[model samples]
Target: MSKIVARGAGVVSGMIGGAIAGAVFKQVWKLVAGTDEAPQATSDEYGWGEVLVAAAVQGAIFGVVKAALDRSTSRSVHRAIGG
Candidate 1:
Protein backbone atom coordinates (compact mmCIF):
# COMPACT_ATOMS: atom_id res chain seq x y z
CA MET A 1 0.00 0.00 0.00
CA SER A 2 1.02 3.57 -0.51
CA LYS A 3 0.97 4.29 3.20
CA ILE A 4 3.28 1.36 3.86
CA VAL A 5 5.69 2.47 1.16
CA ALA A 6 5.69 5.99 2.50
CA ARG A 7 6.39 4.79 6.02
CA GLY A 8 9.20 2.58 4.78
CA ALA A 9 10.76 5.47 2.91
CA GLY A 10 10.51 7.66 5.94
CA VAL A 11 12.21 5.06 8.10
CA VAL A 12 15.02 4.56 5.59
CA SER A 13 15.59 8.29 5.38
CA GLY A 14 15.59 8.57 9.14
CA MET A 15 18.09 5.74 9.46
CA ILE A 16 20.44 7.28 6.92
CA GLY A 17 20.19 10.66 8.57
CA GLY A 18 20.73 9.16 12.02
CA ALA A 19 23.79 7.24 10.86
CA ILE A 20 25.42 10.28 9.28
CA ALA A 21 24.65 12.41 12.30
CA GLY A 22 25.94 9.76 14.67
CA ALA A 23 29.20 9.43 12.74
CA VAL A 24 29.70 13.19 12.69
CA PHE A 25 29.00 13.45 16.40
CA LYS A 26 31.37 10.60 17.11
CA GLN A 27 34.12 12.30 15.17
CA VAL A 28 33.48 15.62 16.88
CA TRP A 29 33.58 13.94 20.27
CA LYS A 30 36.89 12.36 19.38
CA LEU A 31 38.30 15.69 18.36
CA VAL A 32 37.10 17.40 21.52
CA ALA A 33 38.28 14.58 23.76
CA GLY A 34 41.55 14.08 21.88
CA THR A 35 40.80 10.47 21.25
CA ASP A 36 41.59 8.52 18.10
CA GLU A 37 38.55 6.26 18.30
CA ALA A 38 35.14 5.99 19.89
CA PRO A 39 35.15 5.10 23.57
CA GLN A 40 32.52 2.45 23.13
CA ALA A 41 33.60 -1.09 22.54
CA THR A 42 34.66 -1.72 18.97
CA SER A 43 33.12 -4.58 17.01
CA ASP A 44 36.24 -6.64 17.20
CA GLU A 45 36.83 -5.99 20.88
CA TYR A 46 33.43 -6.63 22.43
CA GLY A 47 30.50 -9.00 22.35
CA TRP A 48 27.13 -8.22 20.73
CA GLY A 49 25.59 -6.86 23.93
CA GLU A 50 27.05 -3.38 23.71
CA VAL A 51 26.29 -3.08 20.04
CA LEU A 52 22.68 -4.15 20.49
CA VAL A 53 22.13 -1.74 23.35
CA ALA A 54 23.57 1.17 21.40
CA ALA A 55 21.48 0.24 18.37
CA ALA A 56 18.26 0.03 20.38
CA VAL A 57 18.83 3.44 21.88
CA GLN A 58 19.58 4.98 18.53
CA GLY A 59 16.54 3.35 16.96
CA ALA A 60 14.23 4.59 19.68
CA ILE A 61 15.51 8.13 19.32
CA PHE A 62 15.23 8.00 15.56
CA GLY A 63 11.70 6.64 15.72
CA VAL A 64 10.58 9.35 18.07
CA VAL A 65 12.04 12.08 15.87
CA LYS A 66 10.54 10.62 12.73
CA ALA A 67 7.12 10.30 14.32
CA ALA A 68 7.19 13.88 15.54
CA LEU A 69 8.11 15.18 12.13
CA ASP A 70 5.44 13.10 10.45
CA ARG A 71 2.79 14.34 12.82
CA SER A 72 3.79 17.94 12.29
CA THR A 73 3.72 17.55 8.55
CA SER A 74 0.32 15.92 8.66
CA ARG A 75 -1.07 18.76 10.75
CA SER A 76 0.33 21.31 8.34
CA VAL A 77 -1.28 19.54 5.41
CA HIS A 78 -4.61 19.36 7.19
CA ARG A 79 -4.47 23.03 7.99
CA ALA A 80 -3.65 23.84 4.39
CA ILE A 81 -6.70 21.92 3.26
CA GLY A 82 -8.93 23.67 5.81
CA GLY A 83 -9.63 20.37 7.55
Candidate 2:
Protein backbone atom coordinates (compact mmCIF):
# COMPACT_ATOMS: atom_id res chain seq x y z
CA MET A 1 0.00 0.00 0.00
CA SER A 2 1.12 3.53 -0.61
CA LYS A 3 0.42 4.49 2.98
CA ILE A 4 2.61 1.71 4.31
CA VAL A 5 5.35 2.56 1.91
CA ALA A 6 5.11 6.21 2.86
CA ARG A 7 5.34 5.40 6.55
CA GLY A 8 8.29 3.05 6.21
CA ALA A 9 10.07 5.33 3.82
CA GLY A 10 9.48 8.27 6.13
CA VAL A 11 11.03 6.45 9.06
CA VAL A 12 14.03 5.17 7.14
CA SER A 13 14.53 8.46 5.40
CA GLY A 14 14.29 10.32 8.71
CA MET A 15 17.08 8.22 10.20
CA ILE A 16 19.24 8.66 7.15
CA GLY A 17 18.41 12.35 7.06
CA GLY A 18 19.54 12.74 10.64
CA ALA A 19 22.81 11.07 9.84
CA ILE A 20 23.29 13.29 6.82
CA ALA A 21 22.52 16.40 8.84
CA GLY A 22 24.92 15.40 11.58
CA ALA A 23 27.69 14.84 9.08
CA VAL A 24 26.95 18.17 7.42
CA PHE A 25 26.88 19.92 10.78
CA LYS A 26 30.19 18.41 11.76
CA GLN A 27 31.82 19.62 8.58
CA VAL A 28 30.28 23.07 8.93
CA TRP A 29 31.23 23.29 12.58
CA LYS A 30 34.79 22.39 11.80
CA LEU A 31 34.85 25.15 9.23
CA VAL A 32 33.30 27.66 11.61
CA ALA A 33 35.17 26.72 14.78
CA GLY A 34 38.31 25.28 13.21
CA THR A 35 37.89 22.10 15.25
CA ASP A 36 35.94 18.86 14.92
CA GLU A 37 34.87 18.93 18.53
CA ALA A 38 31.68 20.91 19.06
CA PRO A 39 31.45 23.30 21.96
CA GLN A 40 29.24 22.57 24.96
CA ALA A 41 27.09 25.14 26.67
CA THR A 42 28.10 23.90 30.13
CA SER A 43 31.77 24.30 29.35
CA ASP A 44 33.24 27.56 30.51
CA GLU A 45 35.82 27.43 27.76
CA TYR A 46 33.11 28.11 25.18
CA GLY A 47 31.02 31.24 25.55
CA TRP A 48 27.23 31.52 25.24
CA GLY A 49 27.45 32.91 21.73
CA GLU A 50 29.54 30.01 20.49
CA VAL A 51 27.29 27.41 22.05
CA LEU A 52 24.11 29.06 20.76
CA VAL A 53 25.57 29.43 17.30
CA ALA A 54 26.47 25.76 17.17
CA ALA A 55 22.99 24.73 18.27
CA ALA A 56 21.40 27.01 15.69
CA VAL A 57 23.59 25.62 12.94
CA GLN A 58 22.82 22.03 13.92
CA GLY A 59 19.07 22.72 14.06
CA ALA A 60 19.11 24.43 10.69
CA ILE A 61 21.00 21.59 9.05
CA PHE A 62 18.68 18.99 10.53
CA GLY A 63 15.57 20.87 9.39
CA VAL A 64 16.87 21.26 5.86
CA VAL A 65 17.83 17.61 5.62
CA LYS A 66 14.50 16.44 6.98
CA ALA A 67 12.55 18.57 4.54
CA ALA A 68 14.59 17.43 1.56
CA LEU A 69 14.41 13.76 2.53
CA ASP A 70 10.68 13.93 3.21
CA ARG A 71 9.99 15.33 -0.24
CA SER A 72 12.26 12.77 -1.91
CA THR A 73 10.87 9.82 0.03
CA SER A 74 7.29 10.88 -0.66
CA ARG A 75 7.96 10.97 -4.38
CA SER A 76 9.69 7.62 -4.26
CA VAL A 77 6.83 6.04 -2.39
CA HIS A 78 4.33 7.43 -4.85
CA ARG A 79 6.35 6.10 -7.75
CA ALA A 80 6.64 2.70 -6.12
CA ILE A 81 2.89 2.60 -5.65
CA GLY A 82 2.33 3.69 -9.27
CA GLY A 83 0.52 6.80 -8.16
Number of the top TM-score candidate = 2
Writing each residue's lDDT as its tens digit, candidate 1 over 12-38 gives 666766676566556655665565554
Error of 1 at 26 (Å): 6.3
Report model 1's TM-score to 2 decimal places. Answer: 0.50
lDDT of 1 at 20: 61
Q: Rate the local accuracy (lDDT) of all candidates.
A: 0.60, 0.91
Q: Write the per-residue lDDT of candidate 2 for residues 1-83, one digit (tens) a residue.
A: 67887898899999999999999999999997899889887899988888999999899999999999999999888887888
Candidate 1: where are CA atoms >4 Å away?
1-42
Error of 1 at 65 (Å): 0.4
In terms of lDDT, model 2 sits at 0.91
